[model samples]
Target: METVNVAELVERLGSDEDAVRKMAVFKLQGNIGDPSFADIFIAEGGLVRLRYLTLHASGNTLAYSLTSFSRLLDVDKGWECVDQELVERIVELIVTHPLVNILRGAMSILVSIVSHPYTGNRTSQINNFGFRALKPAIAIYPQFLEMLVSRLSSADHALCANALQLINSLMRDSITHDPEAEWPKFIQKLQDLGVIRAVYVLMQDSALQDLAHPLLEFQSLTKVLLRKWRDIPVNQEKPEHRRALKGIYLASNPEKNPDEATENGDDTRRSRRHHPEKWRRLGFETESPAGEFYEVGFLGMMDLADYVRSHGDEFQNMLLEHSTKPSRQRCPIARASLAVTSILYEHFEVEKSDMDDTKTYLISESRAGFDKLFQPLLLHWTRLHVAGLQAFFRLWKATAAEEEDLDKLIELVRILIESVVGGAARIKDVQDVEEELADFEYHRLRGLQMELLELTYEDAWGQHLRQVREELHHEALQFVKEQRIRSLLQGSWFALDSHSRSEPGPVQKSTATYQYAQLSHNRRYLHFGQFDLMGDRPPELDTLPEKISNVSVNPDHSSTATLKTAPRQPTTKITIHGYAPSTATGHGKGHSHARSGSRTTQKEVVLLTLRPSSHSIASEWLDGLLMLLNQQPITAETSKLIDLVSNYGLKIRLLNVRFDDATFAGEAPQVPARDGLDEDYYYDVFGGA
Candidate 1:
């Protein structure tokens, strides 16, 4: 309202940063509703500038533009003074501007122009420039396009990409109801005029493939365009097709991780979300934002069917098998990768007949041969996942990384848990940390604390977790295996019996084993009375048996394996240290005091002390234990002995061994000689040792 105040505000606008100036402009902008002061700057010789920006541009015009555009696009109250003409002029200047620093900001301003609801009263060429206008710019100015393309060839990869994207925007198309519209006729004319091939060559220039997510992205643009338009054929792979396949490969495999925080079974198609303006700028021709998605629907299936028909069913089936059961033989992530690509390959099958003819569609069996096809990619993903998981755990543990690195941690979670284990119906926390770490409690405890940290402990401790997660890596593999078999059964793709398909080696069936009351010859994987642990063990030797139980020794059962006869070595009698039973089953077994062998006759026991908790359960062996402890105990200890310490809620029993059944205890074709370990002293030393 006051001239002095306006001049003061204008002067202050040039100080420091544009953000402060933007606020002044924003505040002053409201005062213009009466239209007393003009919107333009009056310069010398009657020259007019649309707006005076000298006060705001302190060698940071881009930053200033960002501030200006932000207020112009504010959802609540957009600046009516900012018209589409000003936005378009700004965009044009940004692209051709000498300073590249302002490009992103200029792009933002253009985005604000269309996206900003306040351009209600504006008129500009951009109102009609939508997607359709951007698709055929080469015909309008081929030499200009060529010059820009050449200049971009020397630029950095990202800059080249941006140039391509901007070029696409310049030539993009907009929606129109009439098929016979002037623009459509113009495009057809461009095609008729031989501009299509030449322009296609220009766009396919190898230098800027990443600019748009084109089918051309898969390989160098030059190769792709040359393959399509050149006279000499290279018989090369189609870049666009591969890029589409790769895109499908990456997106469809959203992990069903038990370790994730999101709800499972929600829509798995979130990756498809796109912006219409971006679609317009990228020159997408179809109704969908990504024309590739539509093209894949129509052509992807047909191509795959032809592939399977050429490769044959046997080969296809082999691909699926390699993925599912790759134990020492199979790779886990390799299987997942094949499954990812396979499912995605089927997703866009537009015609049922097209799908049926291709054995690669839908059936899990198609994934078997993917070890070869997928190994390199799988290895890359595996390395990435491992690095990510390790970093995530580190961050989680408050170790090398920090809680502030959650964006990376969450990204890792998305990849590992959400994408890999998507079908986990439920999840629970892993609470048996103590049990799982029985062998190395202290070291494992430290690791556990570090990993569990302040992150996700409640979720980890909850129930149904294991069910959702257990053998996930294994079970998903099985699902993939069965899926392949299902595919073979469909004559639509690879008919199992089809002669036209590959002639495969006969499917190898595992020999079924039979063990019966009378027959023994049928056992294939085992030999007479032999057993081994699935994993490695410390060398087990027949050393003296260690007394593990709290129960006192039974002196009368004098077999060599169970005997505790030794010249009394008066060692300090320390109570054996041990862990609580890790499982309900181990707890239910109570004090584990029986002699080493399943049979009654055993000799030589290593002395052990029990924890206070398990002492009562071993009362039967107290007298023998006390006898073994002493070189001599009063030998009046009797045959059927019992004692009750009524005040302490205690009972005791003592038994002496009988040499009479020693022969029977050592029977052939009988039970195992030991329960805990090869040495009799194994139990006593387990935790305490």
Candidate 2:
């Protein structure tokens, strides 16, 4: 433990045998801050010994060795201590050495020491040391890059675990300004070395937790990927001849980014229209007259593109001459490949070229070929299958609490329904909700809902679950990403097609209008939506032009086009006016369906059917109805009504809540109807003069 003993240990290098020399050298691995120790290691190649094992230790010995080096990393100078320059130089040697095991160990130590969240005080010396070290480690030896690409492909849990941690540390400090300086360079190195493809392939595995933080968990890298892919490249000055230069740089690094938005990066966000030819889809098909090409089997299809890169043109001629693309749509191979390529391009800007020796490829051809190839591949594995189902269950279990089951379960059914709707090959187990829907999708949908309810019945939050019975009354008003748009098919949502090779209308699934919405509406909401239902009527009600309205060409068109059939009046607020005994609701983090806090109306509604003698009593109330329908915002009257509802609808004076433009907050009268109440009571409850 003493410096003299450590020095003695250090001095034993260059011995007759490799084993003792290795031992004596590693004993002082982290401990040897002595300039003389560096001298000894340098002569016998300390790095080579450090490679296999830091010491003959796993926990304490390893910890002490790493800690010793960490101790040196902070020193200002001299033979006995570590300083910034020395730390940087030492790290450079350890990680860049041929034996990757050494780099992994030293980095494990370095990252642990710097990122100890428990450290009470911020250490500038440590920060400087880290900055100095990380930038060069990335530059001098991106061999870890190859290791990353290799380990990610391996099924071993240990490899996956260590790889995730190592890659995660590389980008943690990208958020702040100071770290940004060195961070970008390291990112570029990763990008240049094709690190992104490896990470993306790992993400598709899904066995790993989705919630892992970027600094500590690789999932955090998703934000960076998404961010990079979502925007147009800033570089326009480059020549088209340099199309092969279609690459990404660290305009920003992942470390300084705190939000982790940059982690799950989008390819469109970072890609430049570089490599016009490279960007193109498969321009020409390989000889239509050729023989059957190589056929790969199902399950565990190694990423051919990645494999090809590591192995070279080996997979390029991986042909399918006599073979035909699988007729089946749900192949996982296609899908996983799609996921793999998208991630590669977005995260690493890694080009996956098809060297079929066929013909020239434009950006469009390259894109189309890739998409067609990837789709069937996606369905190759039943990723959304039963074990996948278990993974999903775990995800929900981790994210939602016992009481949050209602929402979590609902979301699960929704995703499953999507797989079926997308034609995913779901096994026809007795649990399937669609089996009962053979007669009609709507009834089948109800069956689906019932199944979801049954599954969650034992959940603690089960009692609170309410079937979301009513579908949206309006169809065309679907919200995607908070912007309203004309939805495509009923119940089908939209996402920007990262695969769309088009230029101006580059957005996928957009159909001229998709990004507008991210609503809570059920998929079926669009079927009977206002856009489809309103044949014709008042031009004022017509969101579309008159020319389009005339296209219906029916005899009743004139009458329907008249004002009588104006679109349903937009009601700004719904104030269910009723009296009730008191009720209570649990406190929540503002969840939409959280229980109310008071005892009052369990079920409440204002009856429009029966007439009140209101017309004869007061003319002023008519103005209030108009106000309610129009939904003017923040009117004193509306605020008062909101306050009353906020307090269990106790203090409201009017049965009406004026509209403040539809969808405004505090619109719904939050009161509930009390059970066991009288029907006739509605008449007398508010009949007092």
Candidate 3:
């Protein structure tokens, strides 16, 4: 390789020939990282020359000059070579540059300077050069924010993307490094500048999707701005916004006039400029990098779960309308939006007025919004995109928080169950999907897999996802059991007779309504209709079983209160109370009807007067209730027997019906041999015993 002369390149950077200037700038760009080169560049007036070319040169020379300056400022000692004058010059060139490459070059330098660390090197440590340059550079934050926002409307996509990234870097620095007192005011100023609205507009640009860096940065910045201002009331007084380009001339050009002093007009201004050390104290160095960046658009309108929580119907309509575009549906943006939307809908709170009809909420507007939100998620299950699947699990987490009401929760759980089942089965089908994908698309999917693997099953979130699924399955099983119990208890029955110690009251000739009956099967619980019973609506009933004691039936017969004993007919007078000792009604060895063994005694009071039907029907119900209490099977025969017993004036006492399967067991009886068969009838023929 030929020997290169730093002196010659420095001189050539000022050449009348464009080729010489371009060559010099490019060679200088290669040497900004070398401490020796940075030293010589600073000593040989390289910063002054580069600023000259950036502001005065044109075409390739200007682009090359800006690139050289950006590279120089990107290093530790190199930051010292430039100052506020050069920073203002670079901003000026970016704002005024006609060529796209020149604009990109200048904006890159600004971003490099803005995101430059306070602790990246020793020189920055010694003289605080990074802050010296940054103090004034940051003053341009408001200006650059507006510049990028306006450029977002540019017809040239590459320029718009570059502008967006520079804007993001600038805003990130301000929030992360600026005075804590200044944060709210800065954020409010940004909001007033329409930063949020501009990002949304840029997101809609079809041309920018392929530009991953700027597109992603725009999303990240939007999220930060949102979370910062999320709690700030919109109607509050606006912060006293600093003017755009407010501090462009805070420090005079050291290159143009090395003796120029910083202005000190007001006492406050003197205190601020005299204390550049105070600027360094602003904790910019400690800002940790923002958390893992999700590629899927979680910052979009679709990502705002708060919006959906407060304004669901309107947002649902917007999402549906947005999804109809073929371009939007095919892009990665739409997939992210849909994934998040589905999750938000799962845990969506029904309004207080709407809670009475939760099922209707799930099936609203002919089910169009529900289908739109979830159909794509189910369809794409085979793809195994981690973000989408994580969103699915997140939805489960939110739903489980309020899954206590078995009936209400099951409605949503069934949808999730179907999705999980279908997704588990869909893995085999994904192999047929073409393995080939475009570079951007492939990187997107790979990013998703990395994020998912980071939350391997042993981690809290992974364990939580598994927990939610298990919980849903458990709830579903309980729901099914309750339904079965409900189906058994709901039916018509005849009450033939009722006897009480007290005189019977007049009975109304109406059918009995037995919608709920508490039972003590395994553990105790009150049973109500799981599904609607025989009415326009299911009756609401308490789910905890209640006990009653000393219950006696009082029945009124229109024709006769008691029958004549002449024909061996029994009298209708019956006394059901005190038939069994109090201890016998408690948790005895054979008392299967009792609940809560802790209770010393639980006398179940069967209120027979609630039955308006005949005595035969009333007794059938009593048999049913007893069967439920003892956890015994009550079939059609049991009902018939109870009815027949009631007609004969003999009530079947379920308390005495104890199951003793051991006593019922017996060996088969020995068979007696037939006389002719045991005889020698075959012995004479075959001699075969």
Q: Please report the candidate that would top lDDT against the real structure.
A: 3
Q: Tens digits of per-residue lDDT for model 1 on 567-611?
A: 122121122222222233332111233323332442233222211
User: Higher TM-score: candidate 2 or 3?
Assistant: 3
- What Cα-based lDDT does every candidate model obtain? 0.31, 0.33, 0.44
Q: What are the TM-scores, per candidate, against the unseen true structure?
A: 0.26, 0.30, 0.35
Which 10 residues in a row give candidate 3 its minimum summed lDDT?
283-292
Per-candidate alpha-carbon RMSD to the true structure: 28.3, 28.4, 28.6
Number of the top-ranking candidate, with TM-score as the measure: 3
Error of 3 at 306 (Å): 11
Instruction: List residue ranges in candidate 1 displaced over 4 A.
Output: 1-48, 51-95, 113-129, 132-296, 299-689
lDDT tens string, model 3, 139-196?
Answer: 7653655665677677777777777767766567766666554655665576678765
lDDT per residue, candidate 2, 311-414, as tens digits?
33211221111012222211222222323333323222213222221133223344343323222212222222322323233333344333224344335434
Stretches of candidate 2 exceeding 4 Å from the true structure:
1-21, 26-96, 113-127, 136-160, 176-216, 220-689
